[model samples]
Target: MKTVYGPYRSWRLGYALGVDPICRQPKVCNLKCVYCRLGCGGIMVTERGRFVDEDRVKEEAKEILDKEKVDVLEFRGTGEPFLAKNLHEIVRALRGLTDVPFGIVTNGTMLGRDDVRKELKDFDVIVVKLDAVDEDGFRRTNRPHHSITFERTLAAIRDTIAESKGDVIIQVMFYKGNVALADRISELVRDIGPSKVFLSTPQCPEIPGLSKKELTDLVELFSGMDVRTIYTECAKER
Candidate 1:
């Protein structure tokens, strides 16, 4: 079986269907987080642009929403949705197709760019990956593209949320060795003050060598904060 994925319920947004906008051509993303489903292939430093059948992707989203009456339309799968360059246009088109709320999942490395933030500001929900709180942890877990600096990536996230005022949900996926400092994460969230800060781990074997207890512990830590935890695997049981 092909893992029988979604339309599964999301923690913060709602139900989602792990859709890939790029459609698996050839491209690179900013992060190489160990728990990611893309394996080791999709990590790249930089690229100009790529082609995706935007019309088809929109059609599929429409069909899925029409059939299921889902709560949110989330764009995340094989690779980063923001990398598609034409993501804004795709989201704009998706708005016309359904009343469902729209969202995008990204590594937050590109959000600092003016064009990227501009395109994203109109979205209903924006989930950013913040696995590391500082440069060292950022390097250790993310294994980001060489073109991206940790400072630049972090700054972009802060600036994007400051200007957009959209539902900016920051996700921190905890790992054992490559763990980010909790103080740093707390401080960053305090400063950025996104709509929510979601702490979770690889519930499925999207990436290997992760443990359930570690994720549970991270959630406990974040419970002290004012953010909401979007527990996909953990919440399903409840």
Candidate 2:
């Protein structure tokens, strides 16, 4: 199967080449997020292994780059890209194969490690998932690995953003469970200082989200901050 899938339309990142760094049949990730498009059968796999071969990934990238007029190379695997031990090697290999800008959509769990953060800084853009600001919210929403606490992930997010060299986008998925945490999430966002904040609802598994009025209010709440809703991008296209 082709590891690199689409130059799919993404409102946030623009035309991009999607890269899957993992190889599991069902695929494995660190979070069993309720809203994951992959569904909740998601497992919390933290082992650092070579999910896919770097040479094969490079070949796949070359084939797509030759045909697609993509704006960027987005590393969004079926699972977390960072969980793959040689992600940086894959990144380096792809750079040699093409000149497209690189970006990654990560769950931010592995960012707790210094090496992961260092390796990640090489990308042109980084989108981190921050669905909850507290432990209770974390368990209910993300269902992260038992070993990783909310505090650790939050600290990693803050620390990574504080020192990240690339454009940082903190994505907060607002579902029925953590919608109330918007204000608190805003507070935390203010403290962390990301380049942009992406407010979105589950586009998969079809979870309940804030109503139009509520979403408008949530956008207003982050008015001072550089916040944008997923729908805002859609509205522009329309």
Candidate 3:
């Protein structure tokens, strides 16, 4: 599979080009999120390793950048981006090749590590996932690895927001499991104080999404913060 793909239009990132660092079959990720569009069939790993060739990624990226213009170069794909140990190296190489800002869509599991945070600072935009506030809600929504915990993930997200030089966006995927905890989730979002908050729901048929009215009700809770919702963006496109 190609490491570089898509100049696809995104609701949050606009016309985004994606770089798949963990370009493996059956997917390789630490979390087995219940609402994951990728589904449950994948390797669950906590340790980071070099999954893709840096030179090959650079070559593909250069070819695409030379030919097509994109709003942002996003590091995300079939698995957790932080699982690739050579992520920093890949990001550094690509940075020199293109002036287009770098972005990453991560689960925030690896942000606890000092090295991870240090390397992530190089990116221009960071979009981290925070689906639930408490342990029960967390486990139910994001069935993470045995080694990962709610407390650690939450703390790491807080620290990442505090330390990041670029825009740190908190992406909350509200579903039947976590909708009731919206107020608490909003409180945590306020406490973390990200550059923006993206409210979303799983688009997959298996996982039901909230109605437009239900999602609209959440807007007031995130008052004073820059907020965007999937529903509102859909309406904008119409």
Best by lDDT: 3
Candidate that beats the other on TM-score, 2 or 3, i.e. the better one: 3
Model 1 pairs whose backbones collide: none
**What is candidate 1's local distance difference test score?**
0.67
How do the residues 72-122 of candidate 1 rate in per-residue lDDT, one tens digit apiece?
767775566677777766777777877767787788887777677678865
Candidate 2 per-residue lDDT over residues 1-238, each given as its tens digit: 6778776766668877788888565758988888877766655688878888989998888887888788888888778888889889899899887776898989888898877977976699999999888899999998888998999988888888888778999988898889878889888887889999888886644777776567767887677778777776652211
TM-score for each candidate, following the candidate numbering: 0.84, 0.92, 0.94
Judging by TM-score, tell me the better candidate of 1 and 3: 3
Off by over 4 Å in 2: 211-213, 235-238
Backbone clashes in candidate 3 total: 0
Ranking 1 against 2 by lDDT, winner: 2
Scanning candidate 3 in windows of ten residues, the lowest lDDT window is: 229-238
Error of 1 at 1 (Å): 15
